[model samples]
Target: MKWSEVCIHTTNEAIEPISNILHESGASGLVIEDPLDLVKQHDNKFGEIYELDSSEYPEEGVYIKAYLPMNSFLSETVEQIKLTINSLKLYDIDIGNNHVSLSEIDEEEWATAWKKYYKPVKISKRITITPTWEDYSPVSSDEIIIELDPGMAFGTGTHPTTVLSVQALEQYLNKDDLVIDVGSGSGVLSIASVLLGAQEVHAYDLDDVAVESTRVNANLNKLGNQIIAKQNNLLDQVNLKANIIVSNILAEIIVQFVGDAWDNLEQNGLFITSGIILNKKQLVKDKLEQQGFKIIQVNEMEEWISIVAKKVL
Candidate 1:
């Protein structure tokens, strides 16, 4: 079989949204090549076993690559992706050059090409996300390992948004508490919640692909029984109350359902939200406050921000 590699040259600000666009367009297995990663300092405490190549990255901006099966609708799909990316301007995102290119490759080559970009990294104090292909062992008995094969899903469990959510969950999740993970991409947070002693987790995602990915990762970590992965919109039909609710999604989408999240949580229940850019941080915070949530903590990593609020009313 043949595969086409679609590469987009974009800015860091646009990575999350553009990646979502690609995933929604039927692309599988994404690779992000950010030039900043070359100079960024990584802590040796987690493990610095993987080597990187400086020559493979662009001099500026970032490149996001994904694979799509070469089929009759390939051209149409690519066009739609471009159109959707252009639509991101409505959200005030800076798309940079927005140059897109495509190349053909053998299935064998495409299968393993993305592995070099993914490695074991400790994202938070207790959580480390490692690709399934890597051999990673925990440095401590208390460390939690999330094995993910992102496949075509949006979450790798290493993104700043995800890291913030997991770290917040670590600090706030009570033992045997019920967790509601909205936009549970790859089910990483649900698995983390269970690992952190949540009795049961209800993981929800609107994308069927993400729902399956979450289930796959949950079972990979041997926590499938503890996480109920389902395809559902954000808190629209949710009736059961949870001790804590976590969402690592865009601030725009999050604001739309802030009220619903408030209604779904038990009194004083924790609500953690990420995937917000620095510029939009205040906006999301204000929305949560308007919905009767009290802001408890604000965490930031790189250009991303995560706001943790509590439903006090």
Candidate 2:
């Protein structure tokens, strides 16, 4: 299979409006990236709600989108989006009359060519990861280990939510605990939870890539049996009552799951959540509290925060 990419120039201020316009223009999917994220440094906006890597990206000039020929409207959609950019006076991502370009490449080239920025990341002292093709060893003396393939799956443990979820799992889990990981991205949290002591783990996510990624990660850890990865949305599809529930997803979605996450837990079961920006912390806290879950702990890192709460009567 071959893929085509459409590149446009615009400021950060115009990204969303442009994205929406492009979506309305009939694009199937979007690959949003910040030009500043190519650097290790970052800048915080909206209390980290608007995060930018803030140093420099290799091709610092354009924001690119890729889709099949069936979806080239993204280019025309973005072209129209630029007219609004002129009205808004945003300077961060100015393309200045640049034309969108298209390129064709083999499927394998996407991983090797487009993914140089993503590197393997470890969570806590327990997990160590090497790509499936890369040879690695797990120390028998250490606590947790996770192996992964290089892909777009959520849990390389690099995101704040994943790290926080791993830590939260460590704090509350016991060898006898039954854990459910909702929105289990790369099976990172599920794999880590089991390694941390959860007796059994049932992991679920809505995305097929995530389900397969989690499964591959499980195989990498040689724990194909410990982390049961399933392609589902929430716990409603599953039959078991969970002693712990971990969700590392966006704040908006967390609000929707507040009631359901509560329903799936065992009495006094733990609910761990991250993927919230700092400003939205209280918002999520209030919503979860309204569902009768008492906040147990909060971990904050780089304007990103995670919360662990327990179900109460």
Candidate 3:
């Protein structure tokens, strides 16, 4: 099999919204590579291991995003994705109209390129996500561990958005709350929600890789039965409201989701969102306020912002 990918370089502020726009136009979820994330790969002396300890990681960078296709390839899908980008006036973003093609390699072979980079990261007071093949145990007196062999998904627990989402899930959820993770990348948030004490967690993402990753990580955490990973874009299949909703997605999706996010919340439900840049926090805040969600708090780390809001009745 063969595949095609269209990548664009955009400022961090434009990446997520453009990704969502591309996804809506037939491209699947995109790969986001913030400049610092790319740089960290080269700084072997202080690379990934340093990210585990907050003080070690670099603070800011631009973003690189690639829209991917699978099974069969379609030029029209690629064109539409590009058109959406152009039509929306997504700033500081550009890509060749030509799609990059690749011969499909067996999954195992394809993943080796990443092994040199994946490392065990302790994300919370009690939780750690360790990739398979790494030999680091949490030495902290009683740290809980979630081991994973992540392939092509979102939950490495390294991104501040992912970390903040996990932290917010821990802070807001209780033993009996029903939680939903809207963009359950790598299933990290869903797994964390269960580990944090939610009675159950339902997760959805448009990316099959992410859905598969969720399942893999769920088993890693030994909560296979408690976490349900499904393929639905942003609450499309949901029928019931949840006590907590966590979305660590781009700010524009946060804008588009604010309405549905408000509608799918149980009374007083908490909506925790990340993947927001420091420059555009007000755009999202304005949208949430328009949706009748009251901002409860803002968490910022190295220019990334996570906002916690309550759906106002």
Candidate 4:
């Protein structure tokens, strides 16, 4: 089989949304090459270890590469991805140089390319996310392991936004509590929720691909029974109440569903929001407040921010 690698030269701020576009367009796997990873200091708190080759990263803006099967619809999918990424500008997202290019490669080459970019990374105090191919063992008795196949979704569970969400969950989630994961891309959060002690989780995503990816990842961690993956737009019409509702999506989309999230959460229920750029942090905070949520915690990782708000009347 052949694969076409679609590479988008975009800004760091546009990473989350463009990655979503690629995932929704049926990309098999993704590789993000950010120059910051080369220079940023990594905290090996949980014995996290990984190496990045400077040559793989771009000199300036970030590079997001997605692999799509070379099929009849490949061209159409890439074009549609471009259009959707361009649409992000309307949300006031700085897309930067949105130059897109494509290349053909053998299945073997494509597989090897993306696998190198993912490795075992301890994203939170209690959780370590590693690719399925990596042989990793927990460093501590309390450490949790989340095995993810990025080929099935958009993230490896090590992205800053995901890290923030997982850390927040670790701090606030109680044993036997119910969790609702909005925009459950790759289902990492839902899986993490269960591993961290949630009784059950409802994983929702608008894209069926994401829904299926969530299911696959849930099963990957032997959590098929604990997580219910479904296709739904944000929290629309979701009547199931949860002790915690977690969403790691763009700030704009997060604000749109603030009311729905409030409606679907129990009193004092926690609403954890991530995938927010620094500039839009206050926007989300204000919306959550307007909906009568009390801000409990505000956490920042690199250029992204996560807010933990409580539904208090």
Q: Which model, 1 or 3, shows the larger lDDT?
A: 1
Q: Can you tell me which runs of candidate 1 are displaced by over 4 Å?
A: 42-50
What is the per-residue lDDT of model 4 for residues 1-313, given as tens digits with 9 covering 90 to 100? 9999999999999998898888778787788889888777766443233688898888999999888998999888888998999999998999999999999999988878778888898888888898899999898999899999878656777778988898999999999999999999899999999999999999999989889889988899999999999999998888988999999999999999999999999999999999999999999999999999999899887889999999998
Using lDDT as the measure, name the better of candidate 2 and candidate 3: 3
Candidate 2 lDDT, tens digit per residue, 33-122?
A: 555444434332111212344442325544645443425454565566546545543423334444455666565665465344344445
lDDT of 3 by residue, 145-255 (tens): 767765543546766677778777767788988888888877888888887788888888887766877888898779999998999878764786899999988776778
Instruction: Assess each prediction's global lDDT (C-alpha) against the native.
Output: 0.87, 0.65, 0.69, 0.89
Candidate 1 residue pairs that clash: none
lDDT (10s digit) by residue, model 1, range 1-313: 9999999999988998898888888898898888777676655333232477889789999999999999999999999999999999998898999999999989989888777777888877878889888898999998888888877657677677787888899999999999999998788899889999999999999989889998899899999899999999999888988999999988888999998898889999999999998999999999998889999999888789999899896
Which parts of model 3 have CA positions greater than 4 angstroms off?
A: 1-48, 51-110
lDDT of 4: 0.89
**lDDT (Cα, 0-100) at 110 in candidate 3:** 37
Give the range of the ten consecutive residues with the poorest summed lDDT in model 4. Answer: 41-50
